[model samples]
Target: MNLRWGVAGLGRGASFVEWLSAIDGCEVVAVCDVSEAALQRFDGLQTYSDYSEFLEKSHLDVVAVITPGPEHATQSLAAMEAGCHVLSETPCVYSIEEAQAIVDVARRTGLKFMLAEDYIWMGWCQNLKKIVDAGKLGDIIFAEAEYTHDCRGGMLVDADGKHYPASAWGSREDLTPTWRAADLPPLFYCSHTLGPLLYLMQDRCTTAIGLNTGAKVAPEVCPVDMESGLLQTAGGRAIRLTNGFCIAHPFSLFTGLYGSRGSIRMVNLGGLQVKAWFEDDPDGGWQDLAMEYEEREDGHHWVTVMLEEFIAAIRADTDPPVDVYRSMEYTLPGICAHVSAEQGGKVVEVPDLRKS
Candidate 1:
């Protein structure tokens, strides 16, 4: 059965809809965006300026909530209530209330809900998962991940919706901060850093304590420059996550896993590279693992793989790999981490919304 798909938000959603349309059993039938200019991009497909009207008219079997971070929770719930399954972008819910609400509604409606956390499906991450599963990394006792991309370049928008760097706002009086520039504390956007770590360890965060390097980089436009979350799993594993968008750094995603027997690390400094050392290896020194492709190709490959898995789950009437509960596991810790950061690194418990 070809599932009818409607996409919300045309910025990233345009790319997603293209990929969804390319899938054999998925049809991109509708798209919704507040901007008429964006809607015009998908000329042949149905488009809407208002989301509610799109939901009513699209007759979509699935809705991809790829809007802004703050809009994800509300949009996902509305789609599920409208009798459509949902595939939402990361940091799925902004608050614990939103998380619980999504969990409740998804359970009550028996609809499929998946978080589009493609980082976990990256080739290096997948390789790490395989090594961990094979007991090469032993028991993962601690992990660290960082996503320090400099986003200050795209932080401001003019009245005409033309984006400019945060620095450009000084010359233009009509520039406004983009949603991402002034969004939640940086740690709240830690899914990219935390998701792949947890995916490899197969654990959920139970508690988190966080700290932030206050908005020193782009204080005028950005809320926070950098934030770090120290999370603890139920099995006594520790995971450290650092997320920064406005900091002065070349785009880098780094992860290091330390286990009882050995450790492995992967980073995108100049390029993607993985280093590993196992206790039982003949040589006791770290060895570099060959990375097949750069980050761009890896990203495209993962999103395709992730969408295929989601489509397969929807067709089989089963839970997606990153279902509602796991979505919260990947997301809620960062929410609580943000709270912890606000409270001066007080330990915050991540609610198990599955029980609620």
Candidate 2:
């Protein structure tokens, strides 16, 4: 069955549509974006500047919402309500109420609702999940994931030395509109750091306490230079997650799992070197591990693997791997953590939207 697909928000949406088109059973039929330049990416496919009209006319079976943080919830809801299953970029919704709305609509419609937290399906992370599933690690008791990238360089000017964000960005050159990313709290973007760990643990965070180093990059940058969350899972497990963009650091995405019988830890910050400790290992010496790619000939690109699974689930009429319930679990904790940080490290309950 060739599932017709529509994509909204041509930022990451361009990459997403390209990938979806590569899959044999998926067709990119319609694309929507407000920017005329972005529309250039979809030449033959239908394009709409208005999202509501795109949903109304596309007749898509699936829609991927890859807009900025604030737009995810509204766009995804409209897509689902229009009879298209959704794959949303994280943090799937900005608020718990939005999360619940998605849960309600998805449950009521019996359509696939997935949060596209591609880090969770990273080859090394998947390997760790397999190890935990095989009882190599008895039970996941603690975990941590770090997502760090210094994005300031890409903000003010392009690599081609073009100034931006100075109010009429594409128009007046001298005045710049406040970039929407300026107010986005660091943890508001924490799904890339926290999602994979929760996905691997298959658990929800019950509470989160947050601490942040307030922004130092610029007056208009993310108001958090660094953000860390101390989270307790629903099963009484501990987890730590950290994300920040203002820091001067190499782009490193890492996850660590500490379990009852054994533990797996990444040895380097940005690199894939890993060390594991188990009861059966003689003298408790560490052994390095790396992701072994079997299914992919192009190596371990996690994003494609994730998209493949999403399409497969739609084809099989099954729930998406990272359903909205689990999506909320991965997202709501970070949302609460952001609240905690703003409230001076007061612990906040990570609401489970599935309840009532």
Candidate 3:
């Protein structure tokens, strides 16, 4: 069954459009964005600047919420209410309340709600998961993941290799006093770094102690605020997650899982170089494991894997791998970590969404 998709929010939504264009079982039937220029970029696809109008006329099977961080919950709830499934971008909602509300709407509608936590689906991360599930890593003790980038100059890049102006979102006069205040918290964008760790460990974070430096070092270059913090999971394991768009240069994006018997490290995006080290090899002894996967020119095509999984769930009447509940499991910690940072770095207990 081809999943007819109505894509909302054009910036990152454009990536989803490119991905769906390649998938056999998915079609981008309608596109909606606040920008007319964004709508003009796609040829021959039904487009709308107003999402409500798009929903009323598109007759879509799924609505992909690719809007800004603050708009996810409202848009996702609207999509579910319109008798369509929803696939939202990460940091699924700005707060736990919003996440719970979206989850509730999905439950009430009996529709699939998925968070596009793609890092968990990367080829390299999948290989690491296979090894850990095979008991090669033994019991996991501690893990660390970093999504550090020196995008302080700017987050987006244009076709000419020039950085897009940071003022596209909002003007300097409209920003908050500090960088952190200018945009969403750094922990709010933690899923890219946290998803692989949670999936590999098969564990949820029980509590988190977040430490944030409230300084706005480069207010002019990158307006978005930033923060860094440490996360401790339930099984006495710990993982440090850092999200700062204000850093100098694009550095490392990595995750390391240390188990009783050995440990695995996935470096760069798509698990490019996954390294495994056994306890016996203490001195300069680590084997480089081939990722063993082909790279797609358009890496976004991996979203097809996620779409196929959702379609399979619809056919078999089973929940997808990144279902609403699972997405919340990955998201709640980041929410709590932000709350922890706000409370002067207090350790906050992540709420158990599994309970009513």
Candidate closest to the true structure, highest TM-score? 1
TM-score of each: 0.97, 0.90, 0.87
Clash number for each model = 0, 6, 3
Kindly list the per-residue Cα lDDT of model 1 for residues 1-356, writing each as its tens digit. 79999999999999998889888988999999998888988899998999999999989999999998999999999999999999999779999999889999988998999999988877777777778999998888999999998888899997667899999867978998998998867877878888888888888999999998887888889978988899999889999999989988979989999999999888888688889999999878999988642333345667888999998998889989999999989988988888998899999998877677
Candidate 2 residue pairs that clash: 166-175, 166-176, 167-175, 167-176, 167-177, 168-175
Tell me the tens digit of each residue's lDDT in model 3 across 1-356: 67899999887789889887777777899999877878999878999989899999999998989987778888988888899988888778887788778778877888998889886766667777778898878899888877766554454344432344454435433322222234567788888888878888877888887877664665544444566667777777888887776655465677788889898887775336778987766574789888743343336445677777877886676887888888887887877888888888898887667674
- On lDDT, the leading prediction is 1
Candidate order by TM-score, decreasing, is 1, 2, 3
* Global lDDT of model 2: 0.80
Tell me the tens digit of each residue's lDDT in model 2 across 1-356. 78999988887789988888888888999999877778987899999989999999889999999877788999999999999999998768888889989999988999999999886776666777778888987888889888787765544544333545322235543433223336567787888777777777778889999998886655444457788999998888999989877678867776788888898887345456788888777777777776642233347457878888888888888878887788888788888998999999999988877785
Q: How close is candidate 1 to the true structure, as a TM-score?
A: 0.97
* TM-score of model number 3: 0.87
Of candidate 1, the 10-residue stretch with the lowest lDDT total is 291-300
